[model samples]
Target: MIAAVSGGSKDPQAGGGDGREPITAAAVAAQVGGVLVGDGSIEVRGIAPLDRAGPNELSFLSHLRYGQWFATSRAGVVLISPELAELAGTPSTRIVVAKPVDAMVALLARFHRKEPRAQGVHSSAVIANDVRLGEGVTIDPFVVIGEGVVIGDGSWISAHAMIGAGSVLGRDVRVHSTAVVYPFTELGDRVTLHAGARVGREGFGFVPQANGVVRIPHAGRCILEHDVEVGANSCIDRGSVDDTIIGAGTKIDNLVQIAHNVRVGRGCFLASQAGVAGSTRIGDGVQIGGQVGIGGHVTIGAKANLAGGAGVIGNVPAGETWSGYPARAHRDHLRASAAIARLAKIVRPLEQLVSKPFSSSDGESRANSRADSRADSAPDESGT
Candidate 1:
């Protein structure tokens, strides 16, 4: 929350911020700690882009790419960065800031509206006799709490969410609708499981026997550290023997898959559809792009980056960027791709030559030779 004006308009109400309060350009500038260069009394209601903002709306100029739109903008007030503040713009009021984007984000809370969460457990929720719930917990309708489950204060279990037996959720943890927490799983404080997320599920481990295959039972827990957010429909499998642990502040996109015994370090960002095979260790602050595939037992060092669609088969060094199938260094991948393109260009001419028949000159020469051969072979017309 950014510091703002002490008091002028009505306080923001629950579920709707500034609905009855009229925000002015001065108030906006004061809230974001920006310099006011124009009319401070102009009223603004909502935020929009420069091209789309009307006379009552506030707009922002953050990047040079959007500077072109500023000249003809009709916005009543604009938050402009110092670099673009002197640029030609038509707005009546300008609030100059070092970081316009940050200022805009701060102002967003004033206009953002969200539904109020109801307090206390619903009548239809099912809680076991031994379940321990902390203060300010809100359990939605049809949510199931298994025996020995413990949820800390301010935790919210959405409708139809299931907490398995012996699972423990720390303070302010949120389990969205239909999300499942398997038995003995642990979620640290401020962790969020989005709708339909599955945590602590059994891994796909099987041993091939002569007659058939035998499934290995998973006996380990899945643990998410503080501030970790699991996206909707993502699956994190419990370890076959050891725990599957996600470090603090890691964010996983939708449809991600994490196999058993995998350990992810802190502050990693994994895009949608990324899959990590079993027993892989990913270090801190790693950025994995969309649809990247990491092989089993692999090690990715801290601060490593994996590009989209990369297929990682081995270890990745720290602070490196890797891409392509059988992922290598980014520069190496680029070189290989460039070489392949150049080779294709070279092969194209040869392919065309091979596909063509005899050239015009060759055809003419062959025809002349055939004519001479026919003339020589023609029976001696002299009748000698």
Candidate 2:
């Protein structure tokens, strides 16, 4: 689901008109260094897709296949690539750019309205006595801040987020609605925790007891370096005694799970639903595919590529491609799979022979006859 401000003007050509000036198509062409074709005087109020755009809307043609609709579109202004300019016939106005899609994105961002929140703490928020908030911080309604928590400058805490005691958040960190940051967690600058993301949760560790299993105490914290992003519904568990660290510039997808003491290095891309067991160290620039499971205590070296649904049972060396369960080298796994296919062919004939019932003497005679037939089939020096 694409999360954005909801319940605003559904019309693409409308603006908030709150002292923010609207931009024109000619101004956009001049700023982006594009050529203006057709009518340069036509004005556009907002941006939208081709199908839903109205007379005041600004649309674009990126792919060549969609060029057919450009001539029939009622949009007041059209952003077109140089290759698509010929296909657009006498539109209201046209701005020719090298990349039409990128130009459209730039135009949409300039006109989008932001949801407004009061710049101070709301009456419904519950902040503990010992918590320290920096200047210009905004705490939305229903937000809870525990004791000894420190939130840096310009941080926005959405509704229903629970910031545990002693947790520290750096500047410009955005904690989405319903996200939980447990006790003693640390988040660096520009980190974004999507809605329902759980940080510093208890790791899955247990011990056998006389009556039942005893839950291990999680005494450590979770540390996320600068520019890290966690997707919605993902969980990162705290360590038993040491901090679980996710290095800078790592992007984790939705529903991912990182167990206790797992250290993920810088610039790693973890796809959706990927899981790493306890104490596993994943090296820098590693690409782990969706649903990949790495066993506990295993080390994955730098630049390793793990395919989707691959299960790692042992340590993987640097710069290797791995796939399949009990993951091996990709080439070796394919060779082993081919050998197994050939073995199945040989086993099927033997199974048919063994399944047939026969007398003991008949079986012995059949075995002797087969041996003689094999001897006769062999080449001899002279004909007997």
Candidate 3:
């Protein structure tokens, strides 16, 4: 047991500094200084969590709560904090460090290196007159840039992407393959549009008229602030009148739909398949889980957490956690669910009490019928 081990025993080794090379425990220690308690020559190929790590994977014991699972891990090497190293019982080669989590992050990046794209316009790319491409902007093959589009410096527009007229993309923006940006849209710096994402589509708004249902004209533009990332196939609609604004530092996962006139605050995290209806307002730092749906005209306060699969029809206050259909507070939903479960036990006894009288009457009727049949069979006693 490592319970009594001192800090003096920490064997700091350099971690994997060379990019894309399958390094051993010695290399890991060489890159990031940490104490090596086991075989430094063990070769590690990948990084993973403690529960899912294989024999060739490197894992980390970051939180003390996960120490229980560490005893049964099968990783080839593990990074652990000095204080918890003695308590951990994994058979894997242990690297006792000052911060296991930070070391893991550095090692994870080393394992996954990015492929650099060429910084220039492709030969087959089409550009309209008056389209402004800043210095070092890379346009991939078959990209269509519409008239009056302005792309900032160091931006990369991938293959087959369409930037509509009057759209402005800020510095260092990345529009992935097959993404579409409609007319009059504005994208801020360092924004990422993943594969097949759509921006500035017309909102679903109609007015009932005497002749027929008239489609509301979407006149306003869609705007995304700096450091925002939209996942694959996600869509953001243009506002009916006012601009649709997605605040800075927000991440929207795949298949998300943000309707027209929606205003999302900064640092919000919206998960995959989550949708916000038109004119809804989401506050800062809110966390919306996967498959959550917020109704039109609803306002979600700051720091509110909507659990996965929640359906919200009303407003949510700040810092509240909501769940379930027609979403309510998570704690209340749990309590109500528990109460409903208890009702099953309570209803069974009442049903038995209500049915007891009829059961007794049925038993009496059967007994009388048997007696009558016996009397009828005894006619020989009467000497007929």
Local distance difference test, each candidate: 0.91, 0.85, 0.89
Which model, 1 or 3, shows the larger TM-score? 1
If candidate 3 were superposed on the true structure by all CA atoms, what would the RMSD be? 12.4
Scored against the true structure, residue 26 in model 2 reaches a CA lDDT of 82
On the 0 to 100 scale, the lDDT of residue 315 in model 2 is: 97
Model 3: runs farther than 4 Å from truth?
A: 1-57, 63-76, 82-84, 87-92, 347-384
Summarize candidate 3's per-residue lDDT along 1-384 as a digit string, tens digits.
012211222112322222345788988887879988889998887777888777767889877899877989888888988888787476558888999889988877766534457767877898998999898888888999999999999898988999999999999999999999999899999999999999998999999999999999999889999999999999999999988999999999999999999999999999999999999999999999999999999999999999999999999999999999889999998999899899989898999888776677888999999999999888685697
TM-score of each: 0.85, 0.75, 0.79
Model 2 stretches astray by more than 4 angstroms? 1-21, 58-108, 303-308, 316-384
**Clashes in model 1: which pairs?**
none
> 76, model 3: CA deviation in Å?
5.0
**Per-residue lDDT of candidate 2, residues 283-326 (tens digit):** 99999999999999999999999989999999999989998888
Supply the global lDDT for candidate 1.
0.91
Superposed Cα deviation of residue 259, candidate 1 (Å): 1.1
lDDT of 1 by residue, 1-384 (tens): 112212335344322234546688998889899999988998887777888888888889988888779989988899999888888878858999999988888888877654457778788999999999999888888999999999999898889999999999999999999999999999999999999999999999999999899999998889999999999999999999999999999999999999999999999999999999999999999999999999999999999999999999999999999999989999999999999989998898989988888789998999999999998877775864
Candidate maximizing TM-score = 1
